[model samples]
Target: MSADLLLSKLEGVRRTGPGRWVARCSAHPDKNPSLNVREVEDGRVLVKCFAECDVESILSAVGLGWDAIMPPRAIDHHVKRERRPFNAHDVLVALETELTIASLAMLDIGKGKMPSDAERERLLLASRRIRSAIELAVDND
Candidate 1:
């Protein structure tokens, strides 16, 4: 879950400035916002509970552990699909060609020199099939 969403769920929590906020520690007996919670832009939290509450205990009180609270990593998915790899150039070629052909057909329709009804239908169907194939390919491994 996003940090902002998690922070919003904490009762009596309010941002006072950039990366600086005040909140009531769920593990402590502070009546006011005695916990100073500072979140960096990268989502690393620096919390100090003035009521002598441990940071780890406080995080657990807020329904988050160390691993659970860590920011998302950009590592690629390890679960491989039972299909072929995706090639950027191949995808670009397919998309660009599909769009170009579609645009040409649209221009022809505008000029009143469109293809035969059957031929136009065939082209439209082909475009759809190609698009679906491309999407499937991209979604695969």
Candidate 2:
């Protein structure tokens, strides 16, 4: 569902800013508007209740399921494209690329060849990136 349709279904919706609106919270007895509703650039509706109401409860009160807040393309099969999930193989490929570049640079260094300033900077960046990737992989596990 579009943000306009959702806002229309809500009670006491008034524009607070461009693409932003305030509405009465349906999850509880609210005299003043407590719900902040906005449409992001990607066409997804964002709803937040200032009363600290849970999203599920707020959506239930307004008779909308989770799908209502998702991007339209995500709901339409014709528009939705399959996305690959990031896995160990993807991480390994990135690490391999970094390692290959570092290894070649090291080989040149071993042959008594001095690296240019740009090459040295690239080597440092590759090292830092590999360390970061390792940390990410460990944290993921």
Best by lDDT: 2
Off by over 4 Å in 1: 72-141
Q: Lowest summed lDDT over 10 consecutive residues: which window, candidate 1?
A: 73-82
Query: Per-residue lDDT tens digits of candidate 1, residues 1-141?
Result: 234644664678888988778888778776898888776655556678888898788778877776444554412223343357677788788777777777888788899986887768867886787878767876773
By TM-score, the best candidate is 2
- Model 2 alpha-carbon miss at residue 137, Å: 24
Off by over 4 Å in 2: 72-141
Over all chains combined, what TM-score does candidate 2 have? 0.51
Q: What is the lDDT of residue 125 in candidate 1?
A: 80
Q: lDDT for each of the candidates?
A: 0.71, 0.83
Candidate 1 clashing pairs, residues 3+ apart or interchain:
none
